[model samples]
Target: MSMKSTVPSAQPDQFVHDHLPPPEQWPELRFDRPELEMPAQVNAVQALFQRAQQAGHAGRPLLRSDERTLSYAQAQSEVNRIANVLTVDLGLVPGNRVLLRGGNSVAMALAWLATVQAGLVAVATMPLLRAKELAAIIAKAQPAAALCDVKLQDELKAALAADAATAGLKLLVFNTGGAEVPHSLEKMAARQCEHSTPCPTAATDIALLAFTSGTTGTPKAAVHTHRDVLAACETWPRHVLRATPDDIVMGSPPLAFTFGLGGLLVFPMWAGASVYFPSIPYTPEAMVQLIGRVGATICYTAPTFYRQMAAFAQQHGIGKLRISVSAGEGLPDATRQLWKQATGLEMLDGIGATEMFHIFISSPPESVRRGAIGRVVPGYEARVVGEDGQELPRGQVGKLAVIGPTGCKYLDEPRQTQYVKAGWNYPGDAFSQDADGYFFYQARTDDMIITAGYNVAGPEVEAALLQHPAVAECGVVGRPDDERGQVVLAYVVLKPGEAAGAPLVKALQDHVKQTLAPYKYPRDVVFVSQLPRTETGKLQRFALRQQAMQTPSRNPTT
Candidate 1:
């Protein structure tokens, strides 16, 4: 029963091995469909490009923005050029980790495809990450090199400079627009060959290292294989999303998030569809304007964004939109109904995680139930299990256990045992199954908070607060709210001289907003003299939660 690496690759870098869970914990991966079977030596990039070519849509648009549109053929060429630079120019061998930092842009997509094509694992980080946060990931993943947007290189540079672990990290910036920036990926790629062959990687070769805040509140890398990426495309988009070649997809989630990566890039490419990336991050109002202007047929975003944009969509008319997808958080009945009334499009609700890679349970518009999360996707199976890991009877709330083609493979973290047990991935969510096989949500089993569809780890927020000069101690917890389902609330013990008032509270809130994702900012700050701790000196988060629940509510704006 000892944990050991079951499958080792022929590549020089075996960093993935140091972090893989034991073979027995891995889900029983199956490929019953002929389309799902991949060759021993396969590159997911090659398969995606070949799919577009075989569909005879090489000339069709694959990526679109206000500035320009890239055809499938053109996109492939770009990918090949970047791949060439990664291998020939940079001397990046197979299995090397390439950290990618950027928003959802055409250049970012090209870099991601190039990394995979070159047989290197891609570690995509959100653009919102500050230097300290980036430093932690850098120390954990130890990526040899990075490809970043030129505009977003400051924090990454600072991170590398501050952390000795990233001392020699090489950075390649893109979207430099002929600026005299040295080592620009776009500039180097232009001179490289546009016909490099894809790396002869095994189907099971690691393709990505996605970082997720595990139950312990530390960032843990989730290992995903080339086959896993292909399988995701085969299931969700093929069965549920059902995007067609003619559909133009657009969304607000950054490509760094798996949901965004799958929804904005992988799914569209699988169907030979086009995806639109805004020149900048779109506000709720801006997203509606772009949807109307671009004539986007399929939309993907979180529940809160949908609620905020419903009126805008109604006033402006979203006539061209045929499908609206919601995930990242629970979709309230009110938000779903508002979107339906506004756009006449039923919001398809689903539950997914960075561990599974994509949605495993989702309903098509025709089979949707008001409160249920819907049936498991064709390639997956699920059940609710009690604390003892025994299957619970129908309609009983318990831990949600799932097994599918893809499952949790935490990179070299002890939490792997916690997430994967007896070949099933426990996603830390409480749920119940109905007689009809639909799954209904209950609550999160951990201290993580889902605010506006973004998973905010309470400990991560607490760590961020401790970094500020004003904080002596802190505990972060989720407070339930009607608008966002849950909002982050921080209980802080300020420094002796620091005042506890609206001004200091606002300062702490702004500090977190700047330090982490803006959505993770504490909506309410309660000043405390000290935090409750057990005899072992462990902060009693449950005690703090009880206090948070009893505190009088305040307007988030205040």
Candidate 2:
């Protein structure tokens, strides 16, 4: 199969300019032409919600939960029910921040759509984020209200109550299974008249405020407008995924992650396609079963998940898989080979960020390069630059910077200046582009370990290890893993009486595994007296890297 471009490929000079304008002063670049065919619709939420309503009136659109399926009309009526409560009951305004804490379920989708359709900002967060992390995010976003799953309601209440800065944030739980929680969405919507007035919003208005980890200490909110969402839904589908209305897209990543949100929800709704959202967290075997049961044609997930799916499919064949897309982290060469061997489908590698709102560079089904992240999308621009900000020649690895319709707009955070500079956004990644225009991911400019498709900050893991009862101090770095590409490695200075041995190493590993995602657990743990540091007290991470290299591989056989 071959992919033919309708337009001439853009040149590297197209990405560089003598002067770059700030957001307000961006005077329509020469590239902004009618040729671009940007979607007339504004935000993804507004457009999709409106379509869902239209589908309901036509008696065609249907949404299914594990419990039941609702027609388009039924789902629209439910959105109205919740929107009315937010407007009339809670007195939330258009720009009010409403933090959504949940997973990839129909109820979560409904809540997100309802919040945006009501003209409020929806900040969706991962369910697995710890209390401290959530509190840090809450403090920054300063939500007027929080819509959380009942399962996490008690923990959230405790976390917020313990934090003095979150005193004014209100809580509303989803209470899925009729949990013993007050002020559930179910209870509130039932009390309402089952209809709420629609609050119209402009496409330029802020509809989504998604929180993503920053190079700095805490996570920062990336504010995106209705325009950004629609742009992502349209461009990504047309150029990369190339999904049709007949395609049933399925994946393992949670909706909180941008990859899942765009591919799973917006893409389907935009094309009038059917989507299947699993009620439970995705296991490889569970995903195989779902795909076979739903007859899903297109699947969107990370390279790690795809590899696991390949392993699962080998044992129990995936009947109707047409295309599988991989993103969220670098796609290793081995994973790509294994996936192709097992499924006979090329894993479309893409490199995206919360900053760009969705994928900017991805391999179209026909033009996939097995080990590369692929060329820039039709409507975006990308370049590799040196430290002094000069464009690096093709084939030379350098800092990867991006500028496109969907760029970063940090919400009230000064770090915005650090990320978005001179009209180009750098998400702290190192990459290179070949003469043929294929992009290859190198590593994070920061010391973040992308293991099993999760960004694990080396410092964050080091902080977690320091809390262990037997550990006096620790330094964490990522070591290369054959499967994960990188695994967290910890060098610890055990507390005086704690001897260095297998039991102590095992205990430290167990402690970190319990503290964070088990995948981020330190595979190599070395007990030491002290870590080498400079006069200013920066732990010499390069030295730790050498120590990690001397340590044997801890990756399990694939």
Candidate 3:
């Protein structure tokens, strides 16, 4: 079928238009609830800002750090001011993509809100991403401007310098601390009015372009609309998180991740609650300390971090924490039990993906189940289906398919065909539905590994490992471990002069850590003279996994 141009005026970036999958391939979208049905000219930012008008929250804190706090009114004013700069000063029209690079901070949150408020699509990149990864995203998204924290500008600058396509990119730096940076968001917004009107964007207009690492060792942009963002707030936070106006939220996941974006920024704001981003990245110990110090009532993080913080919270009382949310990976029963034992609070486990935007299958604390990953949340329908796309029996294991207000919409990639089939989004996870309708995770149908709740594609790790001078050839796979659920294991055939010893293993591991996110580095390495391969020269990852299973490992705890 030929591509039909829809909403051309709203998508000036031809890349977005050219990459959108055919309408038939899109997952079924529903706005069944009256609250879920947004008006035609709905701006999610304006809707979120309205929460400040709720009684008793006008002067209440909305964003807090150790150094300072911004009240609901103040944060909305800042968001408006930044939006003014983006639209009035920078001429960023609705539909233009603005790349955002920064760690989790108040400034970063403001920039994201401002980008969407101005009707521009936000493309947030992880701070740990290097130039090569940044370059790939730039090439795919073709963002016209970037808002970055000054501290995290080096790699983005290198990426822009290296890519000719981005040479003319508009670079705006934030969090400059009164420094005289030319294109600083602080400086730019200072000259703009603090009460700019929100853009009259349609509810279906694209709002964000979240890039996720794909199984093919490249990044794919997941497009989300204004309605989708609002729908996420309506379902998860309203139904599951159930935060109140008085709740104070804190978490470790970076805002660049969708999990963090929803948990730390969107959900709290949706409830007229406040969010606290630690001045610096918090260690599990520091996270526990901050929660107590700030009187945080709700917390969001992965299972591994919760495990590490459980003992710490017990040692120094968890203060006012009433809820602990876990996602990003499966929450181990042991971790859940340990946390419950320590905090006297049950951990809420949910499963969501970059495709779905946020958790669609989760249980409230009242409906807690021991090992199951909860029933499908309200506003979504999920089913386990066989290879032929037929729904399986309650106790059968098959691909997990779901339909919700938001679903997989990959930007200009053929992988969309694999992810969306018959109008159902396949999250690449294998699962089974019990008689009670609870979903039990089996394993990933793809090669992606979830270690410490971070998704690491094995091929991406292999690519990083092969870049090392000492590695002649390599195959990366996930080996089940007691602590992290799974740890990255690499089978390597070194160069002629390299020795197969502990130092070489350490060197290869360190090289991967330097090349990719620290969590993606191979935790265990085994030297091999050759890698199993097919006649076509494709590396046989199955054989490597088989070998890894046969070898005994010293399951090191993180």
Candidate 4:
């Protein structure tokens, strides 16, 4: 395929396309495989639903929960009705943006699907975001309308009030938990026709604007096309995950996050599998219990989530559960061993980015290595490169560079050059590949901690700390030190019924020394009720670093 923009964009609203980086900034996209092929004119919802029906899976359950279950056919009707509400009632046009704010629920999923079906770009946001964060996203994406969960409308209302630009933006609420509200999406959708047609969108038309989680700094919107997401759906999930229609998927990552968007919705829809969203928020213990009670087969969450659930899994049953996916952050060997010992299942660890959309490196349980994050998915090319962008020899740690069907294209940000250079995407992670091509995660490039003369990775120390029974979860970072430049600081969340004090802190430091090099042990330890994390379940290390820099380090052993 040519790298040129051969197909015309069907979008009328040019805001997103206008804001996109130049063609030169795009990482080269390839759809070389047979499965990756699709027609030039593609609506994501239409493509997915058509694929499922072709597979003879349209009649099966596609959405599941205790309150309601919607099969593919039923969900299609609802999506049509919602699409009509967006286009007809709300007068939204193709390429207009719809801001979505909700928890992971059926109504939230329907809004996202309908937004794309109408050829309008969907900007799904985390449910926990406050008015300030929502205001930032609204300022960036400049959505024309917002579909908010009834329970979460307060913050969205505040954001709309806070931002003068959004004063004219219409707001509609749904998933009222049965509030009998008027002018809600459900009420309007109920009056609309259930046979609305899919909008004619070119495959190259922008489908959505996914903002970075901003672990490094200010959030940047990553532009993804209908073709880009469809291409991704073809690679990893079709080849590696291979979810069956009978499989029921569940997870904790918010739908706003790309990881959750793929794991909970897009990938499952591609396979015609069912998704089970807890009506209430999921706690580790509650999630473990619900997995068995609902008979879910596939689970998607981060390693920290799995670590918290392992203890509950021992007390509860994980009925019919098959695949457990770990992403959003680095997976520690200690956490992997604990999960395996408890459930007798080898976790499917993967590495993906918000920029690329989803996982590109992962393997089946049978092929999973002891410490690596599996080989790169077929249909993609990956290599470890030095700072100079030259490929590094195997077993040498360097920046990870990859190119595939989907790559990075930031919205109006100078960081576009930082992400894509010379047709390859740099995810800014440190990794080393083996002779067999297995990729091992080291840490985020900025996550490396330098103290005295030796360099250390925070995840390595966090991994070592997780080996201790008292440590439930932890995030490690570097704290400023006058003599050594910086010292290792670990913020820990202890297990239930465990106490935190000077003795326990020294014990954790000693354990890390035993597990890794003595110099890598955390010089400072802070016990928190819970570590700060993004809605996607990624540790908010930047937050921890801020706290560490503001306060003095505690070295009980010294």
Candidate 5:
């Protein structure tokens, strides 16, 4: 399976292009839609910069911190300088991978944008990733250079020392607090020109390798291109988000995740909007305070964060906040209602995957429904399909299948078959569609709890449990049972000052039974201080299931 290219790539290093999955393995990319059309030569970062200028926002705020703001003109100048530093100072060519390790800050965003602008593939790692995790990514991606925040360099330094593949990595540090340190990106950039030529990359050339956060198992890098990134902006932002230039965006998802990459950075740039980077990692109280302090218009984070921020937002005020986005996990109806009650703004919920780049299915803020994640985004087609790839009835739960401008393209992994099949991406989400085309999330395809021949969705049960005042967070999984096979079990974190005892457990069970079918109620409840979650804030049900394995259910017959 060979691909014949019509557009010439500017990439000098051919490593990424050579290692791409076979032509047949790529989920079919559709660019037939008028909005999806683009020039053969495209650099996503350059396009974003151009978009801001065309929208008459060159002098407007583009990046913000608590104490400072960078106008679009200033930001573009810095980005160009960094691109020059990457290609000139580091002696790297287009298509070389540059590993980026930082949080959601102006420095991290500039490094990522500059890497892509230079035609280099940016492999951005999570800020909180440990030495072992960093070592695994280094071994897999084998980046030729790294641009890391000085504050978070210890773990990466430890990882580089232990991994043979990092021996050749040329490292530069950013956010040095003006220290004249050697190998400082800021120092190199200052000596470089304030302008650099945008790499003449093909629209099809790789832009970034977004590795899955490894919530389920081993991390897999999902490949996206310049065309793919721009096309997604046309679909989700143009159709659903509709961000204006005046909007100031803030979020908790690290830029390493595509969710943050799009919501907090790319989409904002496309809309000629600015993004705020909190001076510190956001706690619920801090996030609420900063949103008001910065007058953030749109905010993005997981549903759990929304649930935690609701009380703080109600007390301190959400400021100029207009749009609240919930993703990374299913938005429980309880959290949705609670936030709406607190902020009077409907949460703009969406369902997307790292493989797809960004949200492909989300309702416009105007047409939000209680349980639905909205209709398929424009430029894409979606269906609810069964095991045999046949479309299931409108009301029945089935695997969610989607095909659009962007789809799954793993980096030489056998699991490619498991993600992309027959030209569609099965993002491992189970969903049911209504006659009106609205889709309701069931759970992760693997998160469905089977109890006594009846299937239960964990999110549905968690949503019900969250309705109880004492319940804070919960993860539901299937526990092995002696009599009825697997039974539904819940690991719950109760609110502060709430007693966790048999009576509270009974009350929680009764609440679920009242909220849903009695059979779907948790047969066993384990109280814990907190549920296991990935950095992206997705519940780690596999860990919970393993924890369940260690403690048998005692064959509880409810």
Candidate 6:
């Protein structure tokens, strides 16, 4: 689509784009490091762990217990045993998709890797998923069977039986207690390992079926190929993170989301570093404790998580986390500053969508701008286009569009066109570029709350309120107002010792006013126990908006 503009001179020439990086800064592979390439064979499972057999058997991959450590040899043997049963006994085929439900554990990791190796698409999900949500996902993506931990299997079975759509699906329970199962994964593994050759699949073959967090609407599946998944392991650690093999990586995003998959699985494995996966409840305090216990060097999390971590770090001490990154949601400036002060590490803000599979724009540690989402990565193109489909000038806010090899194709959904335009994909985010070519996140174009004639992004007000010490968590949304068309309303969760009343409400309102333009301050404040979140830990602002609409008089009177 050709766009006309007052911005002809604004678009940098392709030559300018090419020369932006110094020749010396170009990626150089270490002689001893494995080559990073999109494999000629496209199978996702094979592309990632193709070397696991040799690596696993030669020396066991490191596994940490609650108090002890397990060797790499032990891990691979267990994973290989599971793979054999999945392929030989269950007749799990290359094309079949298997749903995996469990928290982070050695078994969950083995199940995911084995499913991929056996040529099955792994649909890993959060253990906290409610029955209703699980029913919707199961109906949308009918799996051949489910592999669940025994503890959670009863609830999963009940949820499956309660939903007519998932009745015929088979279930295989794996007791995480390390005991033998007669017909379970361990039992199947005791049989002969498969000697059959794997059917070669292309790099573009779908390896994973990851669902969106569904903070706003029904979750859509983001299909990722073996190549796309491997590309993240290859590109991100070098381009965005630059972590060494010795770095101990840890973070709090669930593995089901690509955010977690990249940090907790791919990045650490590619670097030959150890990744610590905490299976317990992840409060900010617990995260700080984990880092201290593990001597973690790289930490990945959302901006909200960063703020809480920073708060704990200020009161206590955050261990030596040399590299910290934030994505899954926008990083507020306050959180960024707090983390920097606490950890002495710049918090790299990344912007990625489920459709893209992983982060495409993020700050490299050395080149971070205080309030930007960094530059586009190599092999990707990003642009801001106006309503008329013309490219917008730097410093002008417009729809952010992107085109890359890993761009999205929704699973049989008509609204795919709504997010994909002329081969570019956009998840409805509005962004602006500065003259220096840094992208600044604005509101989602559809989510901009227009009050009178002013356009207010809900995130902007929420970020402002979060800067206050008394605020624990908050959501800002537009509530219908007869005279003003829409008024800003804030749902706030106060800190543990903070009181909830008109005084606190007024202080929050005044706090936002002091932090930002007065027009963006919340006119109404409702104290709540907690803000709603989707399974993937993203805030549910749309749900809060609905709640605000339902309770007309719930807004506190100042």
Using TM-score as the measure, which candidate wins? 5
Which candidate model has the greater lDDT, 3 or 6? 3
Clashing pairs in 4: none
TM-score of each: 0.81, 0.75, 0.81, 0.97, 0.98, 0.88
Could you tell me the C-alpha RMSD of candidate 3 in Å?
A: 10.0
Cα lDDT computed for each candidate against the true fold: 0.83, 0.71, 0.82, 0.90, 0.90, 0.71
lDDT of 6 by residue, 467-525 (tens): 89898888888888887788888888888999898788788888888888888888888
Pairs that collide, model 6: 42-202, 42-203, 44-226, 60-72, 60-73, 61-72
* Distance from true location, Cα of 366 in model 4, Å: 0.5
TM-score of 4: 0.97
- Estimate the lDDT of model 4: 0.90
Ranking by TM-score: 5, 4, 6, 1, 3, 2
By lDDT, the better pick of 1 and 2 is 1
Superior by TM-score: candidate 3 or candidate 6: 6
Per-residue lDDT for 527 in model 6? Answer: 87
Task: At residue 34, give the lDDT of candidate 1.
Answer: 58
What is every candidate's alpha-carbon RMSD to the true fold?
A: 9.9, 11.4, 10.0, 1.5, 1.7, 8.8
Q: How many residue pairs clash in each candidate?
A: 1, 4, 1, 0, 0, 6
Superposed model 2: Cα runs more than 4 Å off: 1-43, 51-62, 164-168, 179-181, 193-195, 213-217, 447-558
Q: List the lowest-lDDT window of 10 residues for candidate 5.
A: 1-10
lDDT of 1 by residue, 219-314 (tens): 688889888899899887889889999999999777877888899999999999999999967777888888889999999887757867987998
Residue 505's lDDT within candidate 3 is 77
**Per-residue lDDT over 1-558 for candidate 5, one digit per residue giving the tens place of the 0 to 100 score:** 112237888887887778778978779777767878788888999999998898889999999996678999999999999999999888899988999999888888899999999999999999889999999888877798999999989999999999776788999999998987889999999999998999988988989999997767788989888888898899999889999999999999989999999998999999999999988879999999998988999999999999999999899999999999899999998899899999999999999999999998889778887799999999888999999999999999999999988899888788999998988899999999999999999999888988889999988999999999999999999888777778888999999999988888889888998989999999888899998888989888888888988866632445
